[model samples]
Target: MKNILYTVLLVIGFSAAGTAQEINWVSLEEAVKLQKKNPKKIMMDVYTNWCGPCKMLDRNTFQNKDVAEYVNKHYYAVKFNAEGNEKINFNGREFANKGYNPANANRRNSVHDLAHYFSVRSYPTIVFLGDDSSLLAPVVGYQTPQQLELYLKLFKNNGHTVFKTQQDFQVYAEAFKPEFTN
Candidate 1:
């Protein structure tokens, strides 16, 4: 009886401590396959190992329980290293970084061919893709969980399609109420 009480107490203590949850990130090819099976939007974190904002995005936003839980539930999360050497098969084509230097793997190596294919001009770009794997938008730079939730809910609900002009989006942004805790 004492052992059972102690075990229950331990479980309650751990639950109250609130262990961090992580977004289940899959490869680009895996994400594509998953999309065909389950049909969720893809949220690709286009990042480099040397990028500070990329690290901050991982720590500040991605690690947040609310953000991680919502993303894992609504999107097929992908971590794409902009300077990676891995060959990625996407949209019926293969992409690789031909000029990627092994010695500069941690530094600013050549950008992946897929990054150019997506027209990513900045680091830590959160590239959102449709269920059919078409590019929806590239949200560049670090974003707080609250800031990112606006994009998340908008894309998940296809709110971008209703926008006839940039002002429409601006109005939506102005009226947006973020539910995620920062």
Candidate 2:
């Protein structure tokens, strides 16, 4: 009976480990430094603490196994709080949320300079950047795993280069068949 219990516990542990989906998230500075060594596209999750859709995105989209695997393989993911008080230095410029009030934590605070630079007006914006730290595009709003797969493949495969016109992008979107389960 002791051996049976031990075996069951071991199986449970392994199952938990297997089910864990981890996205390889790094700081913007770390991503920039690492790009010098091995360049890859950057995917930034710009979210605010007070946003409900942002929380839903974290709980649903980012937690998806297929999304985690694809993002980890192709891009250096960065989670940036638009209302947080962290300073960021990118492209020889400094960025910070000057109006971040600790007294009003988790409420609608001031936006970060970086968020302004990216022209992020929404809470859950996914900013895509080139390997050289240039802005590719900004996808604003909460996206499901399957919904995000379109943009992921579009940028990853450099489809943006050819699909310059709105019509071209529309055609591509129409043809895209998402492979992600969730």
Q: For candidate 2, report its TM-score.
A: 0.91
TM-score of each: 0.90, 0.91
Best by lDDT: 1
Across 47-115, the per-residue lDDT of candidate 1 in tens digits comes to 999999999999999999999999999999999999999999998899999999999999999999999
Can you give the lDDT of residue 72 in candidate 1?
A: 94
As a TM-score, model 1 comes out at 0.90
Clashes of each: 0, 0
Give candidate 1 misplaced runs (Cα > 4 Å): 1-18
